[model samples]
Target: MNSIGVVYNNNHELHDYILKGFPSPESPARLKRILQHFVDNRVLENNNCKVLYPANVSVEDILRVHTADYFSFVQSRSLSGGGWLGNDTYLCEGSFEVLLQAVGSVLEAGKAVVTGQCDHAFALIRPPGHHACADKHSGFCIFNNAAVLARHLQHVYSCQKIAIVNIDAHASDGTQNIFYADPSVLCISVHQDPSDFYPFKGFIREMGSMPALGYTVNMEMPQEAGNPEYSIFFEEVGLKVLEQFCPDLVILECGFDSYYKEKLAKLNLTVDGYYDSVSRLRSRWHTIVLLEGGYHDDLGLLADVVLQALADNRYTKDEVNQVNLLASRQSSCRRIFDNKLNELKKLMSSYWEI
Candidate 1:
């Protein structure tokens, strides 16, 4: 039986909007819903899952990816008075502390998996960090949690050749930027086509720069692309690329916004889509899942599904009928997805055998 390590804390609520005029969807309730769902479903009672409390990480850990000047600016801004870091991101007086805990939990989860203490780990933390960059926070993210954890794994555990796979609705622009020139880390972002999406990047042609060419992979899914499209891309492109890269550990930047019911994004990935995608990765590498984005009510459900998949418990039935769901989507969805997939394969053919 594979034991899955879980790290989380409700104190992340302290980072909630303090002086921001608007109520952001990335609120404390997001964590509450997932925690409550775990309790209601007795997820902790499962023999294969264990909850682990994490130690607070030092500022040195934060410096692994972020700049010292930027870190000081965030601390000083939050310490004085909470204000908007940008249009979408806000900061409260306690946000820096909350941010520390979030990073700590992620590190603990990574430590568990890297040390063979657990077969898999999930850090159910937020103010989602994929959008946060080396110099500043953006998209409700204050720190790049996955980037920090990836660097920590290499620094402390000596685990070289890490892969960060992002399945969020938005491009993992910040993460790709941080590792764009580094050859040791492989950054693959599969998100909604950024032509009309937020953080309009992750185009098919945005492979890594010289010396690290083809290390950064981005596949832009067409709007309304659902289960069938996701599965096809994974089998035809995603899995093959990862096989070539052969990472020691795969860090999933898991997000629930790709679900059919998400309010912010147009993609139509259902529960089954998420399960198959994660399952494919689990079969190949030990994975550490870090929460990124997803605002719908089913965030808890999807999180549960991800944990179950990682634990190799794949018997649960999906609540939605994927065939009927796919039939209901606009015809253009599949058409656009096919074109993008072809473009991605062609672009990557020179670097990879695909």
Candidate 2:
């Protein structure tokens, strides 16, 4: 497996708003350091090679999935030193370039997989995009990176069918909103339920609208839903949907927010869960992995574990502690899993054969 990690943001420093004077939670410098740790550990640097692309996502590329007016608005704000288009998002002077680079990196990832330059690739981008919709931007996302890559494959490469799977704890609201009306791209989000979460949207009942009904699948995992449920969803329902959709290529909106260590969302996915999910996808479709959101101290560590799975096509020796992870399997988690899987089948069955 030849996987590449592309980055655009040199995340400069910012003061933390909630901390009301402290440093920002997300720093490009920190992201760089985290990526470096992955390289140093031989998780990435010792294995598949990497390629860097310039931070320039064309306006036309932006217009493919986003509104021309919204593109103009984000660009205009980017000119004046960007900051907070909404919660958890900010526009630094370099944010415009950073965001473009992020999209460019994802586009490059798609190119690698589709062209067979590599068996798989990961775009280690910043300014998370899953939250940004077609006309609005929020939740630290200005533009949807996964959506960008999907459109790149569908339009430029002539992929007739595409499947986008988001594993972020928060719903892939932006990606979902963009393709909600398009039947060609299948958008499936596995995230924390909207009962009380940021950008509250992904619900079991919220399938796609008319003309594109059943194309949008939202598997809203209850808070603290862990590896078992994730695996079941992928093996039983999720992958089956992919088979039914018959995508030419797969674009993964891979987010680490579901990691037990992450503070952004309450899902309890361990590093092992991340590995298993990627490994499953590796077997089925040509995958383009784009980072979405994961605000935890161990972003680098978790990222390394995820790459291990993608490269090896199996779970690496359990590096992260698995104590609590096992406990989830022993608890009432199975009941929850059964219930969620049953609900998911009910929603996806109408569209998928299984």
When superposed on Cα atoms, how far off is each prediction in RMSD?
Answer: 1.2, 2.8
Residue-wise C-alpha lDDT for candidate 2, range 1-354, written one tens digit per residue: 546444434432331233232245555544665677766776656556565554456788888888988888887887776556556666765566667877877887777778877777778877678988888888777888888778878788898988999998888888888888899999989998787887789888878988898999888787778887788888787888888888987888888889987876788888788888987887777777777777777787777776776677343465555665656444665676678778878877887876
Q: 58-157, model 1: which lDDT tens digit per residue?
A: 8899998999999999899888877887748998888888888899999999989988899999999988999888997888988999999999999989
Give the local distance difference test score of model 1. 0.88
The candidate scoring highest on lDDT is 1
Clashes of 1: 0
Candidate 1 wrongly placed segments (more than 4 Å):
none
Candidate with the greatest TM-score versus the true structure: 1
Q: What is the TM-score of each predicted model, taking all chains together? A: 0.97, 0.90
Report model 2's TM-score to 2 decimal places.
0.90
Give the clash count for each candidate.
0, 4
